[model samples]
Target chain A: MDRASRGLPLLISRLDKDYAGKAGPRPVLRGIDLEVEAGAFITLIGPSGCGKSTILRLVAGLDRDYSGSIRVGEAPIRGPDLSRGMLFQEHRLFPWLTVRQNVALGAFHCGLAPAAVDALVRELLERVGLAHAADLFPSQLSGGMAQRASIARTLAGQPRLLLLDEPFSALDAFNRLALQLELERLWQRTGITMILVSHDIEEAAYLSDRIVVLEADPGRIRTVVENPLPRPRDRVSPAFNAIKARLFEALHVDTGAPFAVPTDPAPEEAIP
Target chain B: MSMEVSSGGLAPPGAAEAPRAVPSRAGTLSHPANWRRAASHVASVVAPVALPLLLLGLVASAWEAMAVALHSPLVPHLPEIGKELARIFRGGHFFGEMAVTLLRVGAGFTIAFAVAVAAGIAMGRQKTVAHFLEPAIIVGLTVPGLVWALLCVIWFGIGLTGAAVAVALSIAPALLLNILQGVRAVDAELLEVAAMLRLPLRKRLACLWLPSLMPALLGGARLGLSLAWKVVVLVELFGLSSGIGYQLNSEFGAQNVAGVIAWTLGFAAVMGVLEYGVLAQLEHHLMRWRRTAQV
Candidate 1:
């Protein structure tokens, strides 16, 4: 249980990234600066082209081509490490392996003995409410079940910092809400510093301690809003709506006009 | 209800009764309709075996008719060939020859598989390795198995060594091509997952590469084994003095057409057992996950 407080702080400064476009190297991210405290939940919310996911990938060391500094607990990321676990939008489970095997793979490099690894896998499956589905392959799992199994796999690594790239965006509204609750509970229990990339305003408001709003076209941080809402947040609460309205305003400042699609027009109208 | 009644009224009594009677008749075991269904079900089950049997019967009848018409010793009847096959099985020397041929095939095929896998993986992973080996693979594929068999016989001077070498040289390119395609076709997303996990090379091979490449490897093995059989027999026919191919050669030398046919039949039967019995079973077991996933 001591590992519950093992979350590592992250620091990023003057980060710049470019992709090899058809014409030439095109800038994707520019002047990106952010800091995350240990055991804090941070959500990066932006429009579609904003380099939020790219920033997550860079921090995870999946891409090290960026020019700047990204340090996790005083060490610059050389490459992907066990300390950092990532979840993609897709479950990304190996179809050949059973759920048990996939979860066990997360613990492969942890240097645990075979029996210990087996016990860990069992505990993880149980924790994720997937004990009965342990022997099932990814194909046999429903979308929500598969994502839960993926979460178990990531947790098996005992990561200090968990990066989620729209991990529940593919799920239906009900499953997405269910998983969001589960993810919040997981973050609270494990105390892992979590960074999530999402476009969903409510999702960002519900989970994050600090929501970093980003602007597209050379993605850069626009503002970071501190959430005053308490834990076990109610979706319909006025306090939650206030924070969502702030995030929505931050997201639409660049467009001369207001965002056309108002999720909750009541809050926006009230603000005006 | 009114529409149904009107339609029922519009139809003839016999037509209405006939539709109901058809289902009732089909439900009865003794009915002609039920008998026809049972016959069709049995036919479906037996069709695969029956079609091949019918073809074999046709071939035999044609051979028998040709033998009767020509009245030649070279064109032996099916019974004469069957008798010769029985004679080959009865003789202890046939077993020894078969074992030798099989051993050579096994050795050659193993060599081909090992070399192909290593080379294929290297070529698939590294562009430099691929560029360096592409021309050699192309040339190897282009050259006929007969040419390799002749060269190997000349180089190794007639023995198991010569025959095994010929088989390996002849089939390795095709196997390599198969394995290379497999390696290339490996899922990139899964690989990215492995990289993100920082899985060790050993684990990566066991969990990711091996399973991903399994279908291709099995496919290559099947193709390579069949090719190995033909090449080994071919090399034995010309180079070695003891094998089924050697027996065929000896019979042909003596103008014993029945003996040649019998040896070929024996070889074909063994190949059938191996293809269906061993390789197929292994493939089914290894790929059981895929079958279940589909279900």
Candidate 2:
């Protein structure tokens, strides 16, 4: 509570979050110090239980248990606010709402007029290429399409920061690459500060400007590597391979993933 | 349907960026009028029904031939039942009794439906409330309908109130449990989304909760309807003042098998009409989104 950032843009000077008293004695996130400039694309990488999602949740004000402070421009985050947008791996579109109604909900609590919200909803629907399905319910959507609706709903509030928790980790190979590519273009166009949580080293390599790799158990940042790949990053390029290798090493995947090779195989066998 | 699938498919991050997204739902029927769509809807329904109708005809023929071979008065032909069914439509003293039974059942069922849905939604939304009240629901469900009718007679002293209460008590527990389970089974991620968006509570209930709970509600209604009929008849056979159940009891006492069979067929037809013409229509409208999920 003592530490305070004096109007110093989105500072996290020695941020520590713990959950020791809940059941057993343990902290979900401990001794985490990170900084992101305005409109930077930062990716958080980790193993399954590395608490990367916890870190993002903390920053988004969804979880308030912590030691060190997180100040978004001299203001401490206490609860979820309109300034932060979040998307999860499973698209959480409300089943009762049409695509339009679900997206419009983001603006429901705001002080905007109804017409403005309606116009914005239509504009967003068109942007997501779901203008025609705007009146359709979430159950009517395909998995990929539902995820798009989730992203559109997240962006509806025009939040200053977008926190994504493994948003594309559940998708098939084709959808994953397509969404990642779309994300790249969106990030370039929007210039919003983004903190993406992902387990896939290759995904972090291609999508992030700066990738922070984490190992589990204690959930500490193992490596903070700079992504040197050029824009419109080629996944097959040597530069991309080098970064992906570093991410793998940080995660201690020396013997390869417990299941099998995670890399794309061939055109027809790409799903494996 | 294709449009609905693709509309949700473009989850690629760029779809809502750079003012340029590939138009996936562009060519789909943007808004098919409810009336214009009814024609295709009827065709879809008829295509499936044509087979069942044929099967029913075959079954009726087999039953008639078997009855003839046996020369048993116990098994009557379909034509005799059809003639008796026409007689039912002519409106006799028995039909008046049936109308009274329908009215009583209708009142009891309506009361049960409203109370159960309300209680269920409240319990479903709050874990604390559900935990506290669940024991009472289990007790209600375990107790038999006839026992409740007996209790009602003891408590309310043998009138319409006693019979209706018996009907309500019999059906309410099933509906409550079914609706509660339905509500609880709703996806948690959707609630998280609702919380993040900060929707008005009413809109949250309508858009997120209601549609998800529809199947459970409909299931409860179906179960509750059958129970209503059974309980109403049981009450009449025992002590109800004037109803179809009393008529059945009298017929059974006199060993008029034809009269009993005719009433049973007539009641079965009523249930069939209600399910086919009413419940099916309601289910169709509520779960249209389910069709896309199937694809």
Candidate 3:
């Protein structure tokens, strides 16, 4: 057997989750198998109640009652750890805390010196374009700005892998694009593995190197498509359109229009 | 919507002008200043005597009118009551009585607040604790101030200890209920977020649960303080020899209507001062994070 820590950032096999519903123990996820390479960007695209979030929570070590074997590097996650950070859909910033103070909590368990923590918080706020709002409380922030502050807080922990659970779902299109670009830049700069759960097909295509499409009713992966498009991929480009169309088809969305052919298209019908 | 309305109001009344034209900005400059001037004029007329002061004045006049209409010596006029109050203060009987009552209330309140918080936090966080205390808290809530006062007099035999015990027992349940509700109302999402962040138990309690439960705690403290006074007075009237309640009892027995009204007024004045000077200020300082409605 290969050692767990050899270059693989994450591995999961036969993952299953059952929720105690009013009727009975309802199955939410079943027979999931996935492997994440180090520094890879993977997006789990699924409909509501498809258990994409459940998977993210499981990997983030927030949920432990699942029947899955998940390994992060050499370690099996038993509970939330400092090395794996997760961001929820809501900003969830502590209302009593100022922006800087909220971000400061990210590295609280790291035992860094006070000066170092302050410096880290300042740097993260500056990176997220919220340095000016550092002294303001969460209630004083706009929605987009609060989300950016949340992102800064998450990143301050210096997690080796970041799990984002529909982090941009509540944002407007303009703010969404800006955040997506910011996230991509951060990912590229940090070279940290990221697994994002999202229903936005275009977002999955735009930010991720690989997209895992999940089907509902005992949510399981239906397809995993690798995007061959290069970085800074234009949303309107033929290559981007083709990849998006193929994803739509995998997710069973009928675009009702044919996509423009890519100049260098894959011969396979899909990359699964 | 308001922003759109204000911007529309700021627009120049010209069909040919662009929406973002500089001429429109110049035309709009004086509009808000004029509106501000009108608002200030109205505020200047009404702001000096706000609703609370008006209501207080109304209540005072009504109280005086009722005393005159009733034609009973017991229902003293406001001026007569005020005169008795001044006499009591001038004779130096007021401070000692006030001191005795305050000490009992302060001691009782401190004990109740401390125990209720510890017990409330336990009940809020643990099912077993809540299950054990639920029946007792319910019973306590229903029991009256007079009942606790009588029970304390019987058990401890009519002293400061008895008065303090009665006050604590009578008021603890209110604080407990408020604290428990506050703890339960804390956002579940924030708890999950704290767990994901792997905050230490101490940090979680201090930063998350405590802050979330603050409004309830402070509210309970405010109510508990007022209730403690009432219970202490009842206990003192029934048993003790030296407090404001004892003074009221003596005055009532002597049929000195002005004296009874004077002691009652003194108690009210103390409560009002404490509420305004201490509790209200504490609440404003602690809950400064809360946003108030704007006009």
Provide the lDDT at B244 for model 3.
Answer: 91
lDDT tens digits, residues B179-254, model 3?
A: 9899889998899888877899999988898899889988998889879988888888998899998999998899
For residues A157-218, write the lDDT of model 1, one tens digit per residue: 88999999999999887677767877877777778899999989999999999999998898
The superposed Cα distance between candidate 1 and the true structure at residue B136, in angstroms, equals 0.9
- For model 2, state the Cα shift of residue A138 in Å: 4.7
- Per-residue lDDT of A1-272 in model 3, one digit per residue for the tens? 12223123999999999999999999999999999988899999988888999999899888899997999988998898868988989999999888899999988988899999999999887777677788888877777888888988887777888999999999887677767777776777677789999989889989999999999998999989898678866776656777887888887776777654343444444433
Task: List clashing residue pairs in candidate 2.
Answer: A96-B207, A144-B9, A145-B8, A145-B9, A182-B14
Give the number of the best model, judged by DockQ. Answer: 3
What TM-score goes with each of the models? 0.86, 0.78, 0.88
Better of 2 and 3 by TM-score: 3
Worst 10 residues of 3 chain B by lDDT: B1-10
Which tens-of-lDDT digit does each residue in B1-295 have in candidate 1?
Answer: 0011112111111122111111333267888878888999999999968998899889889989999999998799888998998899895767888899999988898898999989999999999999999998999999998899889989999887888889999899999999999999998878878988889999999999889889999898889888888788788888788888888889999999999998888888888888778888998887766634323
Q: Considering only chain A, what is the TM-score of each predicted structure?
A: 0.92, 0.87, 0.92
lDDT score at residue B128, model 3, on the 0-100 scale: 100
lDDT of each: 0.84, 0.76, 0.83
